[model samples]
Target: MPGTALIVIDMLNTYDHKDAEALVTSVRKALPGIRTLIGRARASDSPVIYVNDNFGQWRSHHGELLQAALAGHHRDLVEPIVPDEDSLFIVKARHSIFFETPLAYLLGQLGIERLVLCGQVTEQCVLYSALDAHIRHFEVIVPPDGLAHIDPALADAALQMMQRNMAATVCATDDITLDATPPVAEPDAAAG
Candidate 1:
């Protein structure tokens, strides 16, 4: 049975960009849902993977990244949801978590065939990552309530594309079942 993983993307952000205020506001609103989902995933033993952008700091480590983000404007959004001791952290140089990162190998090693994606910039990183995951044949699930975006309209469009083009399951955090029960193998279906 393949396992399911909760992929939290680019949440360890230092809100210093031009649109930081708007993004931070959105993230603040989504924090509760993200926290709830993380708790459920932890309770169910489903892997919680934090896929964060390296922010062009090639020499920076996860610890440094965490510290930098926590010291930023929206520490509230990054602190409470910081990776737990058992959680896995992967640093990515690009929007897609699978791009030039060890995410795919790690997921493969853990036998993760399904992914629950959540976090910042719904129209960018989350969108690209979902597309990458789809092409790689992984089942993708994105909880709208668990995501935040710089632009609402673009985020909505991105969600629609993910749903229509990649067959991603766009749902609310409360509606998702985070049980760690092994996934029963099934036959291949059309690419999402």
Candidate 2:
């Protein structure tokens, strides 16, 4: 069976943006859930992949980006979920993790057919990534508590959309099962 991967999205933020105030509040609430999911993934030996926004540093690598965030004022947020040696990092400049990135190819290489996504910006990155994953025929799981958002209402709407339109599983962190066999991807009729 193809493996399941736990994707951590845009969690290494510096919190300097204009929308940081509301986002930080949501992120703080999401931290424990995201952290718990990460620990669970590690314990199960599932791949833990972190996909972060580029923050407009086109040349920056993962380590450099991580250090920059760690040096920023909001180190407390970035410190707890720091990627471990076993974790893989992917850099994304856009809202969708698959947009102009190697993530799709990486997942193919890893034989990752099911993705459990956790992290920030529910109304934006997380939402877009779920659509992209769905279209690519991967089973997508989004744990609401593991997500942060700039606007709670929009985030809730986004989650609903993802659940209904994209057929993503909306569940809690404790309910995730990384080792269970993923359902085979159904052929997309619209693609024909």
Candidate 3:
């Protein structure tokens, strides 16, 4: 049967950017919600895929990224949600998870038809990733409370666009359900 995958985007951050402080603050608030979603996804046998930024390092891998992020200032946020041994990790150089990455192909191989998007920068990476997922014919679901954003207004606008333009289901973390069943056909394909 088709399944749902929880895509955790850019949570393994070094917090070394200009808006790092603001992002960290927002991420701190969203940590618990993200953690809950991760736990639920694991319990439901849904795949937990960490799609993280490579921080401009072309040779960098998941182990290095995890170590750097955990050693950096945001250890509190990164430690609680570290990927397990069975989890999948993909490093991306761009904002979208599917941008020049094998994420779409991997999802296809795993038989994932729906994505539960969580993690940092709701306005940027998360939004772009959701759009790509929608265009690829995958169901998109974003948990607002489980996402971190540098700006509140922009984040809200991004979420609205994901809902209205991409037909993504913008839900709260508590309401999301990851199961083994495939997604039902959306009422309107144009929306997603």
All candidates: CA RMSD (Å): 5.8, 5.9, 6.6
Local distance difference test values of all predictions, in order: 0.91, 0.91, 0.91
Residues 105-190, model 1: lDDT tens digits? 88877778999999988999999999999999999999999999999999999999999999999999988887584654564686
Assess the local accuracy of residue 25 in candidate 2 as a C-alpha lDDT between 0 and 100. Answer: 92
Screening candidate 3 with a backbone cut-off below 3 angstroms (N, C-alpha, C), the clashing residue pairs are none
Off by over 4 Å in 3: 181-192
TM-score of 2: 0.91
Q: List the residue pairs that clash in candidate 1.
A: 165-192, 166-192
The model with the greater TM-score, 2 or 3, is 3
Clashing pairs for predicted structure model 2, backbone only: none
Worst 10 residues of 3 by lDDT: 180-189
lDDT for residue 54 in candidate 3, whole number 0-100: 90
lDDT of 3 by residue, 90-125 (tens): 999899999999998888777799999999899999
The segments of candidate 2 whose C-alpha lies over 4 angstroms from its true place after superposition are 180-192
- Model 2, range 14-39, lDDT digits (tens) per residue? 88999999998999999999999999
- Report the Cα lDDT for residue 45, model 2: 82
